[model samples]
Target: MTKPGRTLLKVQGLTKRFGGLVAVNNMTFDVHEHEVLGLIGPNGSGKTTTMNLISGAFPPSDGSITMNGQRLSGLAAHQIARRGVSRTFQLVRVLPGLSLVDNVVAGAAFGYRKRWGAEAEQFARGLLERIGLGDHMHLPVGSLTYIDQKRLELARALAGEPEVLLLDEWLAGLNPTELQEGIDLIAELRREGRTIILVEHVMDAIRSLCDRCVVMNSGAKIAEGTPRDVLSDPEVIRAYLGDE
Candidate 1:
């Protein structure tokens, strides 16, 4: 088992309301350094909403978010990103017009430590190579197949050198083979001790990659613990499968 390090990110009493509808309600969780924490739940459970709040896509209506004990809730998206938080969207997003290398270079130049010029290019290339996109570095992002596009997005996210990485349903649309490949790539990241908050429905990936899991439903956390314990909890089962 991988023992978690100190708490790197903390989400406390986080809530978001779109008018009368609550997207995330009083949600709280901690992500430890060098640990992969799975945020798993049924559809519309606010998993992605929680991720957005942490990554600064949207501010919380109530509560706070902190990283390394520093407040992050009020910062803008770019500001939060520069503070060592990076994320991939539930929908894959890339600069389609840019070449693979340039797209990743953008991430390197703007994110975290902020590399530039040839250094940024070199760093981007190395990340692409690590993600298996090196051979296609010069290709336009739109030209790659769907799975490869997903790979490119990951490389870009990693180029930022984030202390905390958030992945929202990253394995959603893959075929079995592609899913396995994706799982393997994530597992490799875990071995390197990356701190990741993964919002996923894939049970196999959740079981294999997560050090702990926080399960939610209707925008509120319902269970949290090791994957084995939470997945078997009666409340969690009821949330996913409903009352019999």
Candidate 2:
């Protein structure tokens, strides 16, 4: 059995309802320090809702969220961000008219220490370079391709210098080469000791990056184990991979 280290994030009986629909139901899991946790399931399986709940995109209807032993359930998104959590959204959002670097600078303004002026731009620029957006820094964000826009979202999130990073389908639109580049970038973050929760459909990235994975179905956790184990389970196979 793999031993878990210090708990970085904890969710107990987490549930969210949008009117009559229970989008997430009693989901419970813990993310450990310096480990990548994969949250995977088929489309509409509540993966993104889980990320939103953890990142404070909105309040949960029920359950508790704790980080480093402190309650985080009722905090606003930015307040939660201040507590060392940063996340990339399922839909990449960037200011269309802003220069590429400026979009990241906006994130630095709200994330943690609140960097400003040239210092913020310099820091944001460095992150843009790390995420492979350096050459396009002066261009309007709308000019970038879909894959590059995703990288910009990641750069913005990293500007926060977060301890725990939650990524929701941030690798959606990449080709094979760009996919490998993203996988390498995530590996580097893991090497730097950042705890990550990755919600992705790409099995290759999950296998390469996650030490363990949690499988969800219909808003409930169906299995939890090493990537090989969970992916091979009969239920996981049935729910996801069909009868193959």
Candidate 3:
């Protein structure tokens, strides 16, 4: 676990483009160790693109990324994963044919290739329990509810034992109760001292769960501060169309 004073990840002038369009433009930020930093923006504001850049899904068009003070600008996604960064997409990415526990085990196995075999299984099993999916361990991911699939995605990310976790709209499509439960699960992860960068449009979740928020518009950051302050900023309000 990272201590409070450490900077888990830092982004400087990060930008991404596809042909003529800039999806993320000259953005920068820092995620403190063990802190939940929320990333919010309008639908096309490049939030997911930003997540992709940070997690090494693609190299940036320009700029730098660092994690635990190690340069991460050009690494491949798997290499970044091996270096203690993991992520979950807004769309759950579980392997439907595999059991929920088996899916987590695959992640744990990759991250713990150097550990003893039994130890890896133990770690995977424990992670499933921790993420509240222990009872569904034997069930195929295809049979799980959407909420449970979400949980499995989280469990897979956690199984990697990442130093920084990028969560992309983990609450989307959840029912009210499931959303609250998922919020509580995120809080539980925070308590475990994991550093997180969360991209969520759900204002209630942002207010209740984020330590601070970064708001973007038109593929560029517009404001960042405490949730209350950011939410009330005239620019942020304008960007959100007054909570459209």
The residue ranges of model 3 lying beyond 4 angstroms of the native Cα positions read 1-3, 112-116, 242-244
TM-score of each: 0.99, 0.94, 0.94
Score residue 84 of candidate 1 by CA lDDT: 95
Error of 1 at 159 (Å): 0.5
Please provide, for model 1 over 142-184, each residue's C-alpha lDDT reduced to its tens digit, 9 standing for 90 to 100. Answer: 7898889899999889989999999998998999999999999
In order, what is each prediction's RMSD in angstroms?
0.7, 2.0, 2.2
**TM-score top scorer:** 1
Model 3, residue pairs in steric clash:
none
The C-alpha stretches of model 2 lying farther than 4 A from their native spots are 1-4, 242-244
Each model's lDDT comes to 0.93, 0.89, 0.86
Candidate that beats the other on lDDT, 1 or 3, i.e. the better one: 1
lDDT of 2 by residue, 14-80 (tens): 9999999999999999999988999999999999999998899979999999999998898999999
Candidate 3 structure quality by residue, lDDT tens digits, 84-185 = 888999788998877676677777766524333677678778888887888988777778899988888888888888888899999999999999999999
Local lDDT at 177 for model 1: 94
